[model samples]
Target: MTTSAIKPLTVLFFFLAVSLRGTNGEPCGTSSIQVQTINTGETAAGGDSVFEVQVKNLCPCSVRNVRVDGGGFATTVGVDETMFRPVDGGVYLVNSGEPIPSMGAVSFRYAWDHFFQMTPRSLEVDGQC
Candidate 1:
């Protein structure tokens, strides 16, 4: 085979190997992610304040389909960021729509119409690569 043909073949094989190795749902390590509260529980009266949570992606690979589920928040009107979609059943799921790169972060801002406890009982990240 000519040198030029071998070059393309070698590159293809290298990419194929990388893709195969990154399979098995282990490319994005869930343990590498960290969630922190960015808000100090502001007082709200009909859309006056908000509660914020930030998720940092520390995985080696990009994390896609990142969703944040909030539990135990009684009155969550909406989210500040457009990337997040709030469900009707007190579940704020963030559809990143793109991959969260390594060492990158995505934050969710909760907008409430009434004054209530902003503490979420659980903040879970259902992210997939």
Candidate 2:
């Protein structure tokens, strides 16, 4: 290809890459949310296991109304409602429907016989994006 043609192609490819990286400030999706559970080295009074759960938003923009699948979730220890609230059958809301800033995380503790499988179910991108 001619030098001029190659230059324009290079520039076009550069812009395409930037746009794919969300240069337009588009919000990320639920897939960017990470949920991790770990043993906290403590046991509940009922002999259940204690675990710490951290829900992190890996997006560049803030997110609100983060929901997770809490199927069969139970805890002997009470978790703060503002941090994690059980709304319906096996569904929970995180951060009280407030914005979790970009790359921020929310955490809570629970005691149960076993760790429940929690996954990001849904979320709304905050307007700050």
Candidate 3:
């Protein structure tokens, strides 16, 4: 075949490969989520350091039932239970088990002596990517 014809064929193959990958019938995993904590340079009522926590969902699909290892999470300041609360076994639930839309995030604040080692424990894919 001519050089021009081969170039078009290569491009077609590339697009086909990418489309196939998206339809693999698999959902995003906990790895697609990220937990970030930042010191706000402020103190709470008890003189503990205040930290802002943001949990971001990086997956293209929506997710729900997101749980994290609270690790005995505590703070002098109050955090909304509907946003983030410990249920049991040191696991904290996010968004009251509601779906966190694709690329969406949940944020809250806490006051403690040090930053908590928050890590994602589990999540369920709510929709297709």
Best by TM-score: 2
lDDT of 1 at 55: 69
lDDT (Cα, tens digit) per residue for candidate 3, span 84-109: 99888899999888999988999899
- What is the C-alpha local distance difference test score of each model? 0.56, 0.88, 0.86
Best by lDDT: 2
Candidate 3 segments whose C-alpha is farther than 4 A from its true place: 1-25
Quantify how close model 2 is to the true structure by its C-alpha RMSD in Å: 3.8
Runs of candidate 2 with Cα error greater than 4 angstroms are: 1-26
Cα lDDT for residue 51, candidate 3: 93
* Clashing pairs counted in every model: 0, 0, 0
On lDDT, the stronger of 1 and 2 is 2
Alpha-carbon shift of residue 9 in model 2 (angstroms): 7.8
Q: lDDT at 98 for candidate 3? A: 92
